[model samples]
Target: MSIHLENFKNNLKLRLDDNPQLHGFQTFKKTLERDYFSEVSIRICFKEAAKTENLVIEMDCNLDLLEMLYHLQKGTWGGNLSEEEDLPPNSSFARALDQLQELNEISIDVEEFSLFLNDCSIIVKKIYSNSIKDQLGSILSTIAEHYVYFTKGLSETPFEIYVPVFEDTIPENDYTLSKIREADNQTKDYFGFWGLYFDSEDDAVIYDLSNKSIVSGDLYLLNH
Candidate 1:
Protein backbone atom coordinates (compact mmCIF):
# COMPACT_ATOMS: atom_id res chain seq x y z
CA MET A 1 0.00 0.00 0.00
CA SER A 2 3.05 2.20 0.26
CA ILE A 3 3.09 4.82 -2.49
CA HIS A 4 6.26 4.85 -4.53
CA LEU A 5 6.77 8.59 -4.65
CA GLU A 6 9.88 8.70 -6.84
CA ASN A 7 8.33 6.33 -9.33
CA PHE A 8 5.01 8.17 -9.29
CA LYS A 9 6.70 11.52 -9.85
CA ASN A 10 8.63 10.12 -12.79
CA ASN A 11 5.59 8.47 -14.32
CA LEU A 12 3.51 11.62 -13.77
CA LYS A 13 6.07 13.62 -15.73
CA LEU A 14 5.74 11.14 -18.58
CA ARG A 15 1.97 11.28 -18.41
CA LEU A 16 2.06 15.09 -18.55
CA ASP A 17 4.52 15.10 -21.41
CA ASP A 18 2.40 12.68 -23.41
CA ASN A 19 -0.48 15.10 -23.13
CA PRO A 20 0.64 18.22 -24.96
CA GLN A 21 -2.35 20.29 -23.88
CA LEU A 22 -1.56 20.15 -20.12
CA HIS A 23 1.84 21.76 -20.30
CA GLY A 24 2.83 24.92 -18.35
CA PHE A 25 0.40 24.16 -15.57
CA GLN A 26 1.38 23.40 -11.99
CA THR A 27 -0.62 21.40 -9.52
CA PHE A 28 -3.68 22.96 -7.95
CA LYS A 29 -4.94 20.03 -5.93
CA LYS A 30 -4.24 16.30 -6.11
CA THR A 31 -5.83 13.45 -4.18
CA LEU A 32 -5.80 9.67 -3.97
CA GLU A 33 -9.44 8.69 -3.90
CA ARG A 34 -10.67 5.59 -2.11
CA ASP A 35 -11.59 4.25 -5.53
CA TYR A 36 -8.07 5.17 -6.50
CA PHE A 37 -7.49 1.52 -7.28
CA SER A 38 -10.28 1.60 -9.85
CA GLU A 39 -10.79 5.04 -11.37
CA VAL A 40 -8.93 8.35 -11.27
CA SER A 41 -10.13 11.77 -12.34
CA ILE A 42 -8.42 15.01 -13.27
CA ARG A 43 -10.27 18.34 -13.28
CA ILE A 44 -8.77 21.32 -15.06
CA CYS A 45 -10.03 24.77 -14.21
CA PHE A 46 -9.26 27.89 -16.20
CA LYS A 47 -9.84 30.55 -13.55
CA GLU A 48 -9.67 34.30 -14.03
CA ALA A 49 -9.05 36.56 -11.07
CA ALA A 50 -8.70 40.15 -12.19
CA LYS A 51 -5.82 40.15 -14.73
CA THR A 52 -4.33 37.00 -13.14
CA GLU A 53 -5.43 33.67 -14.52
CA ASN A 54 -3.86 30.24 -14.39
CA LEU A 55 -4.80 26.69 -15.19
CA VAL A 56 -5.44 24.60 -12.11
CA ILE A 57 -5.53 20.81 -11.85
CA GLU A 58 -7.51 19.06 -9.15
CA MET A 59 -7.50 15.27 -8.80
CA ASP A 60 -10.08 13.31 -6.84
CA CYS A 61 -11.90 9.99 -6.61
CA ASN A 62 -15.54 9.35 -7.42
CA LEU A 63 -16.29 7.25 -4.33
CA ASP A 64 -15.56 7.35 -0.63
CA LEU A 65 -12.05 5.98 -0.23
CA LEU A 66 -12.16 6.15 3.58
CA GLU A 67 -15.15 3.84 3.74
CA MET A 68 -13.52 1.45 1.28
CA LEU A 69 -10.40 1.36 3.44
CA TYR A 70 -12.52 0.55 6.47
CA HIS A 71 -14.01 -2.41 4.63
CA LEU A 72 -10.60 -3.57 3.50
CA GLN A 73 -9.39 -3.52 7.08
CA LYS A 74 -12.23 -5.84 8.11
CA GLY A 75 -11.38 -8.39 5.37
CA THR A 76 -14.85 -7.95 3.90
CA TRP A 77 -13.80 -6.03 0.80
CA GLY A 78 -14.53 -8.50 -2.03
CA GLY A 79 -18.13 -9.43 -1.28
CA ASN A 80 -19.35 -7.60 -4.37
CA LEU A 81 -17.60 -9.71 -6.98
CA SER A 82 -20.76 -9.96 -9.05
CA GLU A 83 -20.88 -6.62 -10.86
CA GLU A 84 -24.59 -6.92 -11.46
CA GLU A 85 -25.27 -7.18 -7.75
CA ASP A 86 -23.25 -4.08 -7.06
CA LEU A 87 -25.01 -1.94 -9.61
CA PRO A 88 -28.07 0.13 -8.77
CA PRO A 89 -31.07 -0.54 -11.02
CA ASN A 90 -30.74 0.89 -14.54
CA SER A 91 -27.38 2.42 -13.71
CA SER A 92 -24.39 1.69 -15.95
CA PHE A 93 -22.03 4.03 -14.16
CA ALA A 94 -20.28 1.46 -11.95
CA ARG A 95 -19.89 -1.06 -14.79
CA ALA A 96 -16.28 -0.16 -15.44
CA LEU A 97 -15.04 -0.99 -11.93
CA ASP A 98 -13.78 -4.54 -11.55
CA GLN A 99 -12.81 -4.70 -7.88
CA LEU A 100 -11.45 -8.23 -8.16
CA GLN A 101 -9.13 -7.36 -11.01
CA GLU A 102 -7.71 -4.44 -9.06
CA LEU A 103 -6.60 -6.60 -6.14
CA ASN A 104 -3.69 -8.19 -7.97
CA GLU A 105 -0.12 -7.20 -7.22
CA ILE A 106 1.99 -5.17 -9.63
CA SER A 107 5.77 -5.73 -9.83
CA ILE A 108 8.03 -2.75 -10.32
CA ASP A 109 9.75 -2.62 -13.74
CA VAL A 110 7.48 -5.44 -14.85
CA GLU A 111 3.80 -4.66 -14.30
CA GLU A 112 1.73 -1.52 -13.94
CA PHE A 113 -0.76 -0.69 -11.19
CA SER A 114 -4.43 -1.39 -11.76
CA LEU A 115 -5.33 2.22 -11.15
CA PHE A 116 -5.52 4.37 -14.29
CA LEU A 117 -6.67 7.89 -15.06
CA ASN A 118 -10.12 7.50 -16.60
CA ASP A 119 -11.00 11.18 -16.94
CA CYS A 120 -9.97 11.82 -20.51
CA SER A 121 -7.91 14.99 -20.46
CA ILE A 122 -10.13 17.89 -19.40
CA ILE A 123 -8.98 20.71 -21.67
CA VAL A 124 -9.25 24.35 -20.56
CA LYS A 125 -7.73 26.64 -23.13
CA LYS A 126 -7.13 29.96 -21.35
CA ILE A 127 -4.71 32.59 -22.52
CA TYR A 128 -2.89 34.28 -19.63
CA SER A 129 -1.47 37.74 -20.01
CA ASN A 130 2.19 38.63 -19.45
CA SER A 131 1.46 39.95 -15.95
CA ILE A 132 -0.19 36.69 -15.00
CA LYS A 133 2.65 34.68 -16.48
CA ASP A 134 5.12 36.58 -14.30
CA GLN A 135 3.07 35.81 -11.18
CA LEU A 136 2.90 32.04 -11.77
CA GLY A 137 6.01 31.11 -9.82
CA SER A 138 5.29 33.24 -6.77
CA ILE A 139 1.69 32.11 -6.75
CA LEU A 140 2.61 28.45 -6.95
CA SER A 141 5.37 28.88 -4.38
CA THR A 142 3.03 30.47 -1.87
CA ILE A 143 0.74 27.44 -1.73
CA ALA A 144 2.47 24.46 -3.28
CA GLU A 145 1.30 21.25 -1.65
CA HIS A 146 2.06 17.74 -2.86
CA TYR A 147 0.57 14.61 -1.27
CA VAL A 148 2.36 11.62 -2.74
CA TYR A 149 3.01 8.89 -0.29
CA PHE A 150 2.53 5.13 -0.03
CA THR A 151 1.48 2.99 2.90
CA LYS A 152 2.21 -0.61 3.82
CA GLY A 153 -1.16 -0.64 5.53
CA LEU A 154 -4.30 1.47 5.23
CA SER A 155 -3.97 5.19 5.78
CA GLU A 156 -6.38 6.62 8.32
CA THR A 157 -6.88 9.69 6.12
CA PRO A 158 -7.28 10.21 2.43
CA PHE A 159 -4.31 11.79 0.62
CA GLU A 160 -4.85 15.32 -0.58
CA ILE A 161 -2.80 18.23 -1.99
CA TYR A 162 -4.03 21.76 -2.51
CA VAL A 163 -2.43 24.66 -4.39
CA PRO A 164 -4.18 27.98 -3.93
CA VAL A 165 -5.96 29.87 -6.71
CA PHE A 166 -6.26 33.63 -6.40
CA GLU A 167 -9.08 35.85 -7.55
CA ASP A 168 -8.77 39.62 -7.93
CA THR A 169 -12.37 40.71 -7.50
CA ILE A 170 -14.97 40.31 -4.80
CA PRO A 171 -18.12 38.30 -5.51
CA GLU A 172 -20.41 40.67 -7.38
CA ASN A 173 -24.19 40.93 -7.59
CA ASP A 174 -24.34 40.90 -11.39
CA TYR A 175 -25.89 37.40 -11.52
CA THR A 176 -29.04 36.12 -9.83
CA LEU A 177 -26.90 33.48 -8.09
CA SER A 178 -25.08 36.17 -6.13
CA LYS A 179 -28.36 37.09 -4.50
CA ILE A 180 -29.33 33.49 -3.81
CA ARG A 181 -27.19 33.11 -0.67
CA GLU A 182 -24.07 34.35 0.99
CA ALA A 183 -21.05 32.25 2.06
CA ASP A 184 -21.73 32.70 5.78
CA ASN A 185 -25.38 31.69 5.84
CA GLN A 186 -26.27 29.32 8.67
CA THR A 187 -27.98 26.91 6.28
CA LYS A 188 -25.69 27.31 3.28
CA ASP A 189 -22.29 28.90 2.79
CA TYR A 190 -20.64 29.23 -0.58
CA PHE A 191 -17.47 31.30 -0.55
CA GLY A 192 -16.99 31.17 -4.29
CA PHE A 193 -18.75 30.26 -7.53
CA TRP A 194 -18.01 29.10 -11.03
CA GLY A 195 -20.50 29.31 -13.84
CA LEU A 196 -20.12 26.51 -16.40
CA TYR A 197 -21.49 28.45 -19.36
CA PHE A 198 -22.79 26.37 -22.24
CA ASP A 199 -24.97 27.14 -25.21
CA SER A 200 -27.96 25.65 -23.41
CA GLU A 201 -29.70 27.33 -20.47
CA ASP A 202 -30.51 24.05 -18.72
CA ASP A 203 -27.00 23.49 -17.38
CA ALA A 204 -26.20 25.03 -14.00
CA VAL A 205 -23.74 24.43 -11.13
CA ILE A 206 -24.88 25.71 -7.77
CA TYR A 207 -22.56 26.22 -4.84
CA ASP A 208 -23.56 25.79 -1.21
CA LEU A 209 -21.33 28.48 0.25
CA SER A 210 -21.38 27.12 3.78
CA ASN A 211 -20.81 23.55 2.72
CA LYS A 212 -18.16 24.44 0.15
CA SER A 213 -19.65 22.05 -2.38
CA ILE A 214 -21.11 22.19 -5.85
CA VAL A 215 -24.25 20.42 -6.97
CA SER A 216 -25.48 20.47 -10.52
CA GLY A 217 -29.18 21.10 -11.09
CA ASP A 218 -29.63 17.88 -13.04
CA LEU A 219 -27.99 15.63 -10.44
CA TYR A 220 -29.63 17.49 -7.58
CA LEU A 221 -33.09 16.71 -8.89
CA LEU A 222 -32.16 13.11 -9.66
CA ASN A 223 -30.84 12.49 -6.16
CA HIS A 224 -33.71 14.21 -4.41
Candidate 2:
Protein backbone atom coordinates (compact mmCIF):
# COMPACT_ATOMS: atom_id res chain seq x y z
CA MET A 1 0.00 0.00 0.00
CA SER A 2 1.20 3.50 -0.74
CA ILE A 3 1.88 5.72 2.28
CA HIS A 4 -0.68 8.39 3.15
CA LEU A 5 1.54 11.43 2.65
CA GLU A 6 -1.18 14.01 3.22
CA ASN A 7 -2.23 12.49 6.53
CA PHE A 8 1.38 12.41 7.69
CA LYS A 9 1.99 16.04 6.68
CA ASN A 10 -1.23 17.22 8.31
CA ASN A 11 -0.44 15.41 11.55
CA LEU A 12 3.03 17.02 11.63
CA LYS A 13 1.60 20.49 10.95
CA LEU A 14 -0.99 20.12 13.70
CA ARG A 15 1.67 19.14 16.21
CA LEU A 16 3.89 22.06 15.20
CA ASP A 17 0.99 24.52 15.43
CA ASP A 18 0.21 23.40 18.97
CA ASN A 19 3.64 24.47 20.23
CA PRO A 20 3.80 28.05 21.55
CA GLN A 21 7.52 28.37 20.85
CA LEU A 22 6.93 27.48 17.23
CA HIS A 23 3.89 29.75 17.06
CA GLY A 24 5.24 32.05 14.35
CA PHE A 25 7.83 29.70 12.93
CA GLN A 26 7.83 29.00 9.20
CA THR A 27 7.60 25.41 8.02
CA PHE A 28 8.53 23.86 4.66
CA LYS A 29 8.20 20.29 3.47
CA LYS A 30 9.46 18.42 0.41
CA THR A 31 8.84 14.88 -0.67
CA LEU A 32 11.72 12.96 -2.29
CA GLU A 33 10.45 10.09 -4.38
CA ARG A 34 12.65 7.00 -4.40
CA ASP A 35 12.38 3.45 -5.70
CA TYR A 36 12.69 1.44 -2.47
CA PHE A 37 11.67 4.14 0.02
CA SER A 38 10.44 7.72 -0.15
CA GLU A 39 11.65 10.47 2.20
CA VAL A 40 9.71 13.44 3.51
CA SER A 41 11.84 16.29 4.79
CA ILE A 42 10.32 18.91 7.07
CA ARG A 43 12.19 22.14 7.77
CA ILE A 44 11.27 24.62 10.51
CA CYS A 45 12.74 28.08 11.00
CA PHE A 46 11.93 30.81 13.47
CA LYS A 47 10.63 33.87 11.66
CA GLU A 48 12.22 36.47 13.90
CA ALA A 49 15.78 35.18 13.49
CA ALA A 50 18.23 36.43 10.89
CA LYS A 51 18.40 34.33 7.74
CA THR A 52 22.06 33.47 8.30
CA GLU A 53 21.66 32.59 11.98
CA ASN A 54 18.18 31.15 12.06
CA LEU A 55 17.65 28.20 14.35
CA VAL A 56 16.36 25.47 12.08
CA ILE A 57 15.04 22.02 12.88
CA GLU A 58 14.86 19.39 10.17
CA MET A 59 13.14 15.99 10.43
CA ASP A 60 13.39 13.33 7.76
CA CYS A 61 10.77 10.60 7.77
CA ASN A 62 11.31 7.28 6.02
CA LEU A 63 7.85 6.39 4.72
CA ASP A 64 8.74 2.81 3.82
CA LEU A 65 10.14 2.06 7.27
CA LEU A 66 7.09 3.62 8.91
CA GLU A 67 4.72 1.63 6.70
CA MET A 68 6.54 -1.59 7.56
CA LEU A 69 6.29 -0.69 11.25
CA TYR A 70 2.58 0.01 10.93
CA HIS A 71 2.09 -3.38 9.28
CA LEU A 72 4.10 -5.08 12.02
CA GLN A 73 1.96 -3.48 14.70
CA LYS A 74 -1.27 -4.47 12.92
CA GLY A 75 -0.21 -8.11 12.54
CA THR A 76 0.05 -7.77 8.75
CA TRP A 77 3.85 -8.24 8.75
CA GLY A 78 3.90 -11.42 10.82
CA GLY A 79 4.63 -9.54 14.05
CA ASN A 80 1.77 -11.22 15.92
CA LEU A 81 3.01 -14.68 16.81
CA SER A 82 1.16 -17.19 18.98
CA GLU A 83 2.29 -20.29 20.79
CA GLU A 84 0.60 -22.52 18.21
CA GLU A 85 1.66 -20.52 15.16
CA ASP A 86 5.25 -19.59 14.34
CA LEU A 87 6.38 -17.37 11.50
CA PRO A 88 7.50 -19.31 8.40
CA PRO A 89 11.28 -19.22 7.96
CA ASN A 90 10.95 -18.19 4.32
CA SER A 91 8.04 -15.75 4.78
CA SER A 92 7.81 -12.24 3.32
CA PHE A 93 8.69 -10.91 6.78
CA ALA A 94 11.91 -12.88 6.70
CA ARG A 95 12.76 -11.47 3.29
CA ALA A 96 12.02 -7.98 4.55
CA LEU A 97 14.41 -8.56 7.44
CA ASP A 98 17.14 -9.60 5.05
CA GLN A 99 16.46 -6.59 2.81
CA LEU A 100 16.62 -4.22 5.78
CA GLN A 101 19.89 -5.74 6.92
CA GLU A 102 21.42 -5.32 3.46
CA LEU A 103 20.12 -1.77 3.07
CA ASN A 104 21.37 -0.57 6.46
CA GLU A 105 24.56 -2.69 6.40
CA ILE A 106 23.65 -4.02 9.84
CA SER A 107 22.39 -7.38 11.02
CA ILE A 108 19.22 -7.31 13.11
CA ASP A 109 17.54 -10.22 14.81
CA VAL A 110 13.81 -10.32 15.54
CA GLU A 111 14.23 -8.89 19.05
CA GLU A 112 16.45 -6.06 17.78
CA PHE A 113 14.06 -5.29 14.93
CA SER A 114 11.21 -4.89 17.44
CA LEU A 115 13.28 -2.37 19.44
CA PHE A 116 14.38 -0.54 16.27
CA LEU A 117 10.80 0.02 15.11
CA ASN A 118 10.06 1.90 18.34
CA ASP A 119 12.79 4.48 17.52
CA CYS A 120 11.30 6.54 14.72
CA SER A 121 12.84 9.99 14.54
CA ILE A 122 16.08 11.32 13.08
CA ILE A 123 16.11 14.94 14.44
CA VAL A 124 18.58 17.44 13.00
CA LYS A 125 19.05 20.72 14.83
CA LYS A 126 20.70 23.94 13.62
CA ILE A 127 21.27 26.04 16.67
CA TYR A 128 22.55 29.65 17.03
CA SER A 129 25.53 29.53 19.39
CA ASN A 130 28.90 27.80 19.23
CA SER A 131 29.25 27.11 22.96
CA ILE A 132 25.83 25.54 23.26
CA LYS A 133 26.36 23.78 19.95
CA ASP A 134 29.60 22.14 21.09
CA GLN A 135 28.04 21.07 24.37
CA LEU A 136 25.02 19.64 22.58
CA GLY A 137 27.33 17.86 20.15
CA SER A 138 29.17 16.14 23.00
CA ILE A 139 25.97 15.22 24.84
CA LEU A 140 24.13 14.01 21.72
CA SER A 141 27.17 12.05 20.51
CA THR A 142 27.24 10.13 23.77
CA ILE A 143 23.53 9.43 23.53
CA ALA A 144 23.75 8.31 19.88
CA GLU A 145 26.57 5.93 20.67
CA HIS A 146 24.63 4.37 23.52
CA TYR A 147 21.37 3.89 21.61
CA VAL A 148 21.57 1.33 18.81
CA TYR A 149 19.44 3.26 16.29
CA PHE A 150 20.09 6.87 17.34
CA THR A 151 22.31 9.02 15.06
CA LYS A 152 24.13 12.40 15.34
CA GLY A 153 25.85 14.98 13.11
CA LEU A 154 27.53 18.40 13.65
CA SER A 155 28.12 21.34 11.31
CA GLU A 156 29.85 24.73 11.59
CA THR A 157 28.05 28.12 11.10
CA PRO A 158 24.44 27.27 11.91
CA PHE A 159 25.45 24.32 14.08
CA GLU A 160 23.57 21.27 12.88
CA ILE A 161 23.38 18.00 14.77
CA TYR A 162 21.13 14.97 15.19
CA VAL A 163 19.58 14.65 18.63
CA PRO A 164 17.16 11.91 19.68
CA VAL A 165 16.31 12.56 23.31
CA PHE A 166 14.98 9.37 24.85
CA GLU A 167 11.76 9.43 26.89
CA ASP A 168 13.58 8.79 30.17
CA THR A 169 15.95 11.74 29.58
CA ILE A 170 13.18 14.19 28.73
CA PRO A 171 12.66 16.34 31.80
CA GLU A 172 9.03 16.16 32.87
CA ASN A 173 9.88 16.99 36.48
CA ASP A 174 12.66 18.47 38.61
CA TYR A 175 13.75 15.02 39.76
CA THR A 176 14.12 13.87 36.18
CA LEU A 177 16.19 16.90 35.24
CA SER A 178 18.32 16.52 38.33
CA LYS A 179 18.93 12.86 37.57
CA ILE A 180 19.86 13.73 34.00
CA ARG A 181 22.25 16.43 35.12
CA GLU A 182 23.78 14.04 37.63
CA ALA A 183 24.31 11.35 35.04
CA ASP A 184 25.70 13.69 32.40
CA ASN A 185 27.51 15.97 34.84
CA GLN A 186 25.99 18.95 33.06
CA THR A 187 24.11 21.90 34.51
CA LYS A 188 20.48 22.81 33.79
CA ASP A 189 21.78 25.55 31.50
CA TYR A 190 22.85 22.86 29.05
CA PHE A 191 19.38 21.39 28.86
CA GLY A 192 17.37 23.22 26.23
CA PHE A 193 13.75 22.15 25.96
CA TRP A 194 12.50 22.05 22.39
CA GLY A 195 9.54 20.56 20.59
CA LEU A 196 9.67 16.85 19.75
CA TYR A 197 7.61 14.60 17.52
CA PHE A 198 6.30 11.64 19.50
CA ASP A 199 5.06 9.17 16.86
CA SER A 200 2.48 7.40 19.00
CA GLU A 201 -1.33 7.46 19.12
CA ASP A 202 -1.46 11.15 20.07
CA ASP A 203 1.09 12.07 17.33
CA ALA A 204 1.95 15.34 19.06
CA VAL A 205 5.00 17.32 20.02
CA ILE A 206 6.12 16.90 23.62
CA TYR A 207 6.30 20.48 24.90
CA ASP A 208 8.34 21.13 27.99
CA LEU A 209 9.09 24.39 29.82
CA SER A 210 11.54 26.60 27.96
CA ASN A 211 14.93 27.28 29.48
CA LYS A 212 13.87 30.71 30.76
CA SER A 213 10.73 29.35 32.43
CA ILE A 214 12.43 26.57 34.36
CA VAL A 215 12.55 27.36 38.11
CA SER A 216 15.03 26.11 40.70
CA GLY A 217 13.18 23.03 41.85
CA ASP A 218 10.21 23.12 39.53
CA LEU A 219 9.89 21.95 35.95
CA TYR A 220 6.71 22.93 34.16
CA LEU A 221 4.84 21.14 31.43
CA LEU A 222 3.74 23.57 28.77
CA ASN A 223 1.04 21.27 27.43
CA HIS A 224 -0.37 17.80 27.95
Model 2 C-alpha RMSD to native: 17.6
lDDT of 2 by residue, 1-224 (tens): 11122333332332122232322122111111121123322232223433322222232333333453445344444233454645431133333334433544322222101011223433322222332333432333333332222111221111111222213333465553453332232333334432233222133232223322212222221110
- Screening candidate 2 with a backbone cut-off below 3 angstroms (N, C-alpha, C), the clashing residue pairs are none
Runs in model 2 deviating more than 4 A are 1-44, 49-52, 59-118, 122-128, 131-137, 148-224
Write down the lDDT that model 1 would get: 0.24
| Cα lDDT computed for each candidate against the true fold | 0.24, 0.29
Give lDDT tens digits, candidate 1, residues 1-224.
11132332333331211221332111211112321233333332222332212222233333354443344334333223345454322111122222211332321010111211232111111112222222222221221111111111223222321111112222464343334432222211112332222222233333323333433431111000
| lDDT, candidate 1, at 134 | 29
Which ten contiguous residues of candidate 1 have the minimum total lDDT? 107-116
Cα RMSDs of all predictions? Answer: 19.4, 17.6
What is the alpha-carbon lDDT for the whole of candidate 2? 0.29
Where is model 2 poorest over a 10-residue stretch in terms of lDDT?
A: 150-159
